[model samples]
Target: MYKKILVAFDGSPYSQKALTAGIELARCCGSELHVLTVVSLPEYAGTVGEVEEMVGKAQDFYRKKLEKASQQAKTRGVELKIHLLFGHIGETIIRFAQEQECDLIIAGTRGWSPLQRLLMGSVSTYIVRHAPCAVLIEKGKEEDGNG
Candidate 1:
């Protein structure tokens, strides 16, 4: 029933699995696929030049990863749109999904421990609670060798 699908990708093994799932769903539903990678800004402290350099490197890395994802989607006969964003991950993802009018959001979770999740906050959880559309969280699976 989905018309547009957005997947949060970060080049992590978990996110790669999410991409695969998103691709399959898009292929079956004939939905448009959008892959988003967000690069968090460096912590405040370093010189402006250093901060810029770090951000630049992160952007480059995400670009390459997105390119690879694009190629994979193309091979599967699915057109993919890639988005690079900088900001708080959860907020940015929710905003982007809304802006794109996506019907569903597919995201991968690292399966952090309860304590760790409590301390660091869970992006998947936040998205599930706040996203404008439906959210599917692909928990990291041990058998998939991605957990």
Candidate 2:
């Protein structure tokens, strides 16, 4: 019963898997699909010009990734709205999901070890805990086959 679905995509293999799942779910439910890619800018330790150049390159990279995601959704007969966000990945995703009034949020996990997750803080974990809507995390291919 999802009317609006948001997928967090970063062009990684896991994210691509998440996109596929989101697209199929939207197709079956006839829901509006939205894809979001976030660019987490590193703390600037260089000159202003260097910071600007870094941001520019990141934007260009994300643009291409978003374009590819758009094409993939189109091929599946699903129209997708793309969003480019800058900020903390988890917070931005949760905020966008709320702002868009999304009914569901789909994301993919990198399957990190427990220690790594604890130290690095998983974005998927944060979104799962904080998202206003239902969160669907697509498991990695290895995990899917194993379990």
Candidate 3:
């Protein structure tokens, strides 16, 4: 059973699905939930201030998304905390997970076809490959009530 769950989140629907899954997992295990959003600065091609500004904007967006998720956790009475980080997404996630002593890291898979992934790579892939702890790569979408 997981004692501390670290979740990597963004504003994407995929990330939201992972967040919901993380919430349920934490609830079931009575684990402390640590939600993290990483703002990856574009490498070069911009002024320092511009890069900083973009990172700040991304952090703001992450904060808002984390707040939304917090409301859900609060309603369910689940223990949850939020963090916004500025760095390479994969590296930051692994580093934070280790620093926090998180037992598991949950993250969503981004869209990347097999060929494209071989060329450009993917974040979830990197995390799965490099993270020292357990990682769950969630990609499924929410079920429609139509069923």
Q: Which candidate is the best by lDDT?
A: 1
Off by over 4 Å in 2: 44-47, 141-147
- Determine which window of 10 residues in candidate 1 has minimal summed lDDT: 138-147
Each prediction's TM-score versus the true structure: 0.91, 0.90, 0.88
Worst 10 residues of 3 by lDDT: 138-147
Flag clash pairs in model 2.
Answer: none
Between the candidate structures 2 and 3, which one is better when assessed by TM-score? 2
lDDT of 2 at 20: 90
Q: What's the lDDT for residue 37 in model 1?
A: 90
lDDT of 3 by residue, 1-147 (tens): 999999888767778778888989999999999999888788873688988789778866767778988988887779789888888888999999989999999888656679988998788898899888899988754341111
- Residue range 21-134, candidate 1, lDDT tens digits: 999999999999999998777667468897788678988888888999999999999999999988889999999998889999999988889999999998889999999999
